[model samples]
Target: MSPLLDTLSNAVGAAHVLTHDDPGADLSAWEQDWRQRARGRALAVVRPGSTAEVAAVVRACAAAGVSIVPQGGNTGLVVGSVPDGSGTQVVLSLTRMNKVRAIDAANLTITVDAGCVLQAVQDAAEQAGFLFPLSLAAEGSCTIGGNLATNAGGTQVLRYGNARELCLGLEVVTAQGEVWHGLSGLRKDNTGYDLRDLFVGSEGTLGVITAATMKLYPLPAAQLTAWAAVPSLDAAVQLLGLAHQHLGAGLTGFEVMGQFALSLVAKHFPQQRVPLWDEHPYCVLLENSDNESEEHARAQFERLLETAFENGVVSDAVVAENLQQAHALWHIRESIPLAQAEEGLNIKHDISIPVSKIPAFCAETDALLQHEVPGVRLVNFGHLGDGNLHYNVQAPEGGDAKAFLRTMEERVNTLVFDAVARYDGSISAEHGVGSLKVDKLPGYKDPVALGLMRAVKQALDPHNTLNPGRVLSA
Candidate 1:
């Protein structure tokens, strides 16, 4: 063990090699997950400044028969990026490799180190007169490597697509410490096999993503936002249809929030001034990105809202008058999860159903959950345009939240996941199957599909050298 640590220290300067043995060295940031769901112990935390250093670390760990957990911002909710409690795995941190390698304006692509923050990429594109539409609430701290690893679908998935669709190429290090330089920003390439797709959403089980070349879009001329009060989830779905018909490709975002969810935001963060939540069962946030002009975008939004109101789909609505107002509206939408945390500990589900079946799914699941666990408060909200919902559950009012979770977490998950299967939906939509959902996947996921996944995992990481016990069991 000492020799291996010495080898790692030599490969990437000793200063970058942090260990639990060091006095006053705290590894909680890299050991714990974003949700605080599980904290693991790591033998060493290695921060490599370059791809070559990462490769060297991998080679040394492989020779020493040690598992490596590749980590980025440590903002993953599923506990995928952190190490286990064995205290033997190496935590490979990529934050030191932060750099925007190149921006090919002509090709509409930007190549960046895996450690680049998502917001930094977006800002770079904006500065270069382009748009990077992959956005999430955690963009401020989440790295592009983690985003692509989970195939993150954010607010703009309705128009731009998920992280998998936005990426053009990747630079990965195999389990054998070989680098695959696949960062060719070509839109069309008839390659033999699409290795890029294989690793994009692999969750680091297959390889380590060091850098990526992602697609970019032209900046919209005007982006207008609207907040609408809907009578029900069904009406919210109807409003979504109207938005697509009116805005078409310009419909960049359509988020749905339950009244209870909004109330939590208002109750926890009073300064947000959540609108249209008191009188309605749900409120929807819409975004229209137009290339023509703000006037045109406003007109389209107005027409959409007018038709929705006429069709009895909307009770009330308000369109942002300026950029500041638009950002304020978006801020409220992104603050739901944080507000939920502030309220108390809760169970979260990031499930996705077909657009047409979401209403029925929610109605049935809501009834089923209430019947199973009386007085359980539901915090339902997510990207309705893309059919993904963050259908979370809170404990009964004034009860012990921790005790409720300890006793009911398993039951609640089973009830919700069973309903998701009935609706032909996935148990996980945006978040990957980390250790939290790894065991549950076997029961819900198809046997044949699961077998294929295990086969791939064995082929790529036979030694289980990369992210052992994640996505697939070690």
Candidate 2:
């Protein structure tokens, strides 16, 4: 055994460490990512059951100059969890540390171990008669640690905000093997630099987030869902403004999808029939919640639709009658990605611009992409309220997806990112820049911001032992 592996074995015990040649184990799933585009080999996979064990493992890795990749659930899209194929790194799996340390319902907060699955936290909040509203399609499998690391944003961000806003505190294990116990339930703290914010979106480059204290909200008494067919992207944006103007903070989600994307879902998922008057170019899914009666909420949604219809903003609309019906509407919206996946391979970009510029951004980018790549299928859909668009390009008919991807990945990225830059948008909206986008970040990010990030990294991780080659390349 290598000296580093020997030292790790001593620190966390032999059972917690798996060697590179351990064919007896099935680690293929961990080796791949959610997108299956990034794959890597690791020297060993280490599972630590406690924060102390994590600290010890990091100390050992730092001493041996071995890079450590902190992974939770391995459900990330950016290949941040998996190390490079060089097989010189250790995969520190945090799955075994899943636990809810405490829940203070009165304080509207919950402190949970980083390995805790997001759904588990949601269930815990429900058991206490509260709501942990940070939701995503992958909540069932994605861990809270990964959520915090990426500063995850979801549908409800229009109301509750992103993971960073939802988080009140964090318990992180630093690169120097020191456990920073910053977990507090207080809603106000102005001592110094917001260290929690630093590690939340660091993608495991600064530290390993062991646990977090996240804010909770009161469970809304009623939810109203409406699917509206807008005449255009501009109309969709206008309707969103109307929703916010009338609904105020009650408006929870505003998701938009192009007709082509919805058609794919209807084709793939036969049960979810398309519910628009005609094949409109754009559709918006609007969700609202209130403490009053469902009848009142429904009436408010109907009023908005009525106003939109009269003003020619909405071409057609359908409001769900009950909770089950509302879920069905949401099902179609959530199934877009899966249906697209079944269609074929494509380049997926989660880019975001200011909410005001979304329409122009979409119109111009769609034209540019179609012009550049002949017969390209555009699947543009995402949280319109937050301006995050999953602009994906499907291969041409009967074309070899792998061959097309190999030929056009960089070209496609350049086109899309260039458009985002022109619109003052972000290359990565919700997802963090893992190993996949590290090389492309410099061109998009300001040099001063990048320099500050590097300084913070060096200050916290002088040895560059935690998640090396991710987020920033030294």
Candidate 3:
């Protein structure tokens, strides 16, 4: 046996280590990303059961000068969790360590192993009469480690914040195979470095996050959801201002969808039938949650909508009659991405701009795209409340989509990213700079910030043994 393989087998047992010969060893699901953009060969896929085991595996890899790619559920969109083309890198899968370490309902905190599925964590918190608000459509399959690695943002980010905000502490295994136990439920800790923050969004480049302690909130007593048709993106932003004035932070969700985006959902899922038939230029899916009763929440939402209508911000609106109806509305919003994917051959750009700049950004960018890439189909939608938009572009019908993408994908990306830059916004909104965006990081990211990132990476993983060529390229 190879010395490195022998050492890994000794560290985490032989059964947990799978080589190329094992059945399902290189299953496309694990080997490839969600978008099928990255698929790489690995020396072996290792499953370590505990922090100590992870540390030992890391130490062995470090000693052998082998790169380790920490993988969770492999649901990442940025090609972060998969191995590189090198046949020497090891795939460290955390699936075996899935467990709920602790749930302190009294403290409004739940400590869990990093491998636990996000939905499982939410279920545990709900079972304890609390709510873990880090939600995403991939919650059923995406692991907490992957979510923390990317600092995922979902529907609730408008209120509860993203993964970085929802997390209180983390137990990280650094590059040298040393475990740093910073998992505490304390709300306020004025520590020197705030190491927890560093590993949360490090994308497995700085360290391997073994476990985390996350904050929870009281389950909402009553929740309200609305599907409103707005005259334009400008009106949607204005309605958002009215919503803030009326509902304030009670507005837990404020999502926007363009006509084509919603139409795709309806077209893909004909069984659901389009809820609102109005062909408005834009739509806003807003959710309001409260500790008060259902009636109170409903009344508050009605007041906000009424005021919005009076001000001509909202063209039309509908309040979900029941929980099933609310889910139906949200399902439509969540289904847009899948619907787009099902349709095929589209370039997705997840960028963010200031809330105020969204209307102009959309108008200018849309105009530019139409002008430059003539006959381009645009699907514009995302968390407008939080300023992140999934600005995706599709080829004109019957125009050799793949060839168009091949010729124009880079140019489209340049246009979107340049617009993002022009508005002083981020090229990447919620997703981190995984291997997918490593090259683009140099141009859009500030040089000093990039330098500091490299410095920290050097300090943490001097050998570049953990997830090399990921977030901050070596």
Candidate 4:
């Protein structure tokens, strides 16, 4: 047996380590990203069952001068969790540490092992009569550790905030084989440096997050979802302002989609009929939740819609009558990416700007794209309330998707990112700066900020053995 393999086996047991030639060592999910754009070769895949085991495994790799890639769930979009093409890296899988240590209802927090799936955590919270609000479409497969590592933001981020905000404390295995047991579930810790926040979005470059304490909220009594067709993006922005004035915190979610994007969904999913038959150029999906009663929630939404229609900001509307209908409405919003994928491969962008600037940004960007990349199709929608958009582009119909990406992808990205910088926006909003965006970071990110990131990386993982070439390339 190889010395490194023997050491890993001794640390966590032989059954948990899988060499490339071992059974089920295809490394399909662990080595490749969700988009299948980034693939790598790994020496072996090791599963450690506890923080101690993880620390030991990390130590062994450090001593052997072998690099390590810490991975969980493997559902990340930016290829952040996957290793590079190099075959010398060892992947430390956290699936075996799937355990829920404690759920303190009185304190409104649940401390769980990093490998526990997001859906399981949410279910646990619901069963305990609370709500774990950090939700995503991949909740069934994505792990809390991966979510925190990426600082993921989903539909609920508009209200409950991102993974970083929901996380209270973390248990991490640092690069030098030391465990930082900062798992105190205190709401306020004023003692020192915010190491917890630093590691939350380090993308495993700093350390391996073993477990976390997550905040929970009281379950809402009712939720109302609506599909509204707007006259224009500007009109949608006006409606958003009205919602804030009228609904306040009760406005849980606000999403916007262009005509082309909505058409793609309806075309691919025949059963998900569009809300209204109209030549509307824009559509808005809004959700309002009430902690009191269904009647109260419905009344508020109806009043808001009434005002919107009276102002002629909304051209048409449909309110979901029940939970099943609400889910169906959301299904249309969630199915855009799937429909686009079925259509063909496209270049994807996750961007964020000020809520007030979103309308102007969209208008200017749409015109810019049309002029520069004529006939290219745009599939766009996003959390309008939080200023994040999944703005993607596909080759013109009857054109080659692959060839278009090859020739125009980088140029298109430059165009979009340059505009984003002009508008004071972020290049990566929800999806992180994984291997996909590593090269793009230096140009967009401030030089001093990049230097500080390097300093933090050096201090935490001095050997640069963990997730090499990820957020900040070595």
Report every candidate's CA lDDT: 0.94, 0.90, 0.89, 0.90
In the range 287-327, model 1's lDDT, one tens digit per residue, is 99999999999999999999999999999999999999999
Regions of candidate 4 where Cα sits further than 4 Å from its true position: none
Shift in Å, residue 73, candidate 2: 1.3
Q: List the residue pairs that clash in candidate 2.
A: none
Candidate 2 lDDT for residue 167: 96
TM-score of each model, paired residue for residue:
0.99, 0.98, 0.98, 0.98
In angstroms, give how far residue 400 of model 3 lies from its true place.
1.7
The residue ranges of model 3 lying beyond 4 angstroms of the native Cα positions read none
Which ten residues in a row are the worst by lDDT in model 2? 20-29
Report residue 236 deviation for candidate 4 (angstroms). 1.4
The predicted structure with the larger lDDT, 1 or 4, is 1
lDDT score, residue 24, model 3? 63
- Best candidate per TM-score, number? 1
Which residue pairs overlap in candidate 4's backbone? none
Error of 3 at 229 (Å): 0.3
Name the lDDT of candidate 1: 0.94
